[model samples]
Target: METAMSDIKIIMKETYSKLVTFKRKENRESFNKELLKVLPQIYRYVSKRLNSAVANGKLNKGMFNPSDFTDQLFIEVYDNIDDIKSENELHVFLFKKVDELLEDSLVEEEFDHVFFDNIDTYSKPEWDAMEENYTQDGDGDFLLLEELDDSSLDKTNYTLNHVFITDEEKKLADKLDASLDKERIYNHIQLVLDKMNLPMRTVFELFTNEGLTTEEIADIRKTTLDQVEELLASARLLLKNSFEKRFLIDSN
Candidate 1:
């Protein structure tokens, strides 16, 4: 149990120690050994955080693969390794930078996706077939002539004006079509999730994605179990509201 709490910090301390002592163009082999050993853990942490951030528009798909971000993180660690001072400090510092960089990258609001592409789908042959063959049954069978009647024909005879893809209908489709670029949706979600304070984000990712228990998270963050629970709840609520807005779903 205690080991779970200190696992990341312990690895971080060891990794930071190696990185701090590394001289440029010297001890390359030793540094590479340490780099390979710690890369997965660091990458996993960064990836999880970025995954969360990308959903809220805090990052783009390009940054979803955190290999480049992980490199930047390592460089930051190396430059400031001596100043980090402790394993816990390094743990907080490493991921805080990840969140900060994402937040800092917000330059402008992406124009909301205006879905003009899907409006034409209504005019496609499949929909046209429905209008043309309104008398057709589910089995692709037409109404028998013997069964035909004035009422039956009237029900089956759908006029173009009734089923036509009007300009007004297209405008409604545009309004109802919440379809944004897939990547943009992700980016919006990432930005919303990035609103979480770093500690809450860190603990939430550790608990959810890393399979760490709340107790373990409290241990990792050096906080009480109750505090961990609160942070988790706070993050959940923050995301819940953002998700509701994004998806047009309601918790209410």
Candidate 2:
């Protein structure tokens, strides 16, 4: 794992170095060629953001394409790449631009609404009973169906694996592993994440799905490191508690 990560870092450094050279030479073709390498990451983020917006009724599915955002992101990167001083800054700058674009395009709303008062206060039976009532809307089903149609199946990996799990929570994770396959696990995780406040959900997704460090997330969100840490910690606890309530605890 360490070697793979080291290799990726090396590759990213090389890519950034080339980008800098292309920038200096005013070579748009080479710059765009290098930029296309990061398009998968940008596309993944855009797709997730758009899907979430559609699921929440904040945006119409027909109104935008994920590629549209990626194309715009590429333009933004092409225009602003010179502002980035280092490889580290390049990655953060890309995501920061995406967030800015999303903020401008999506309807502005307060994402701080508290969804759960105290998750720990709920009993297992209460959770099980509540689960029986849970249902996905047609838009959500359509979005998920579209996700499933993608050959890559990358969405299946977007679960609670990246969060810090306690020993007890590890047991819940194991239980989930034993009881459900990857797709089901991803579904359960998505449902739980969708219920969370937007800040928590966005921070968690950026950390887990995007594989960003807390410092990177802090930079992208334009928040303090402490605030990012708090949001992540809260997100982790909520995910763990959610899995325990919905999966581990038996009504029987």
Candidate 3:
């Protein structure tokens, strides 16, 4: 137990280190300094998975890397979008190929070795600290989905409207409602992006350009208003969350 506690403290320290380093206004300057350390491994895995997929032809050449579509990915893509988008699509296409391979291959074992192996080393206490410090920001600007009134209107409604989807989008959105992990929605959005094959710039342009109502987004997606509301609610949770994670709180 003591060893576990010590590991937890290390996790907490590392998590806090990332959090505090990111809190600097010039975070962009320091961005990827530490994060880049872990990215190559992820990048390599994605590349390998993608290369195998291209050989299998299960995916188009332009699929995005759905597995690696994290906020960190956004930062990486934002700079050289053309290259990144193409790479992402190829990566995603490959991911589909690998998904097919999973049926016959020991992909689960590989995943366990790659991602899940050290995950157990992650202390729940460290995760709690990450949630408390990295997400909640020692400041109080953070708001959970449950904290928002279902009836309330905010800038977030516009943000949610941007995630275009069909009836199929609802199931993923529902899963997101059940669990507020930003990572889940991030992955779901990547899935949608893969389905649409839309560029990040195009999506970002659409999201920022037009303001959307909960009603309008629902009509566009052909889903019920309630479902749209749920989607929007989940989106709001992510928007605020991404902001807090990437920038310092602006509670003023």
TM-score of each: 0.42, 0.80, 0.22
Top candidate (lDDT): 2
Please write out the lDDT profile of model 1 over residues 17-134, one tens digit for every residue. 7765663445755665565455554555555555444444555556435565656765666666668776556665655565566456534333222321222233334433532332
lDDT of 3 by residue, 114-204 (tens): 2222333444454344344422321112222332232221212222234425565555445445545545334333222222211221223
The segments of candidate 3 whose C-alpha lies over 4 angstroms from its true place after superposition are 1-16, 24-26, 60-252
Cα lDDT of model 2 by residue, 177-215, tens digit: 887787666665665666666667788888776667999
Q: Highest TM-score, which number?
A: 2
**Model 1 collision count:** 15
- Candidate 2 total steric clashes: 0
Full-model lDDT, candidate 2: 0.68
What CA root-mean-square deviation does each model show from the true structure? 21.1, 4.4, 20.2
What order do candidates take by lDDT, descending?
Answer: 2, 1, 3
**Could you tell which candidate, 1 or 3, scores higher by TM-score?**
1
- Candidate 3 residue pairs that clash: 63-89, 64-88, 64-89, 64-92, 65-88, 65-92
The lDDT of model 1 is 0.49
Task: lDDT winner between 2 and 3, please give it.
Answer: 2
- Ten-residue segment with the worst summed lDDT in candidate 3? 106-115
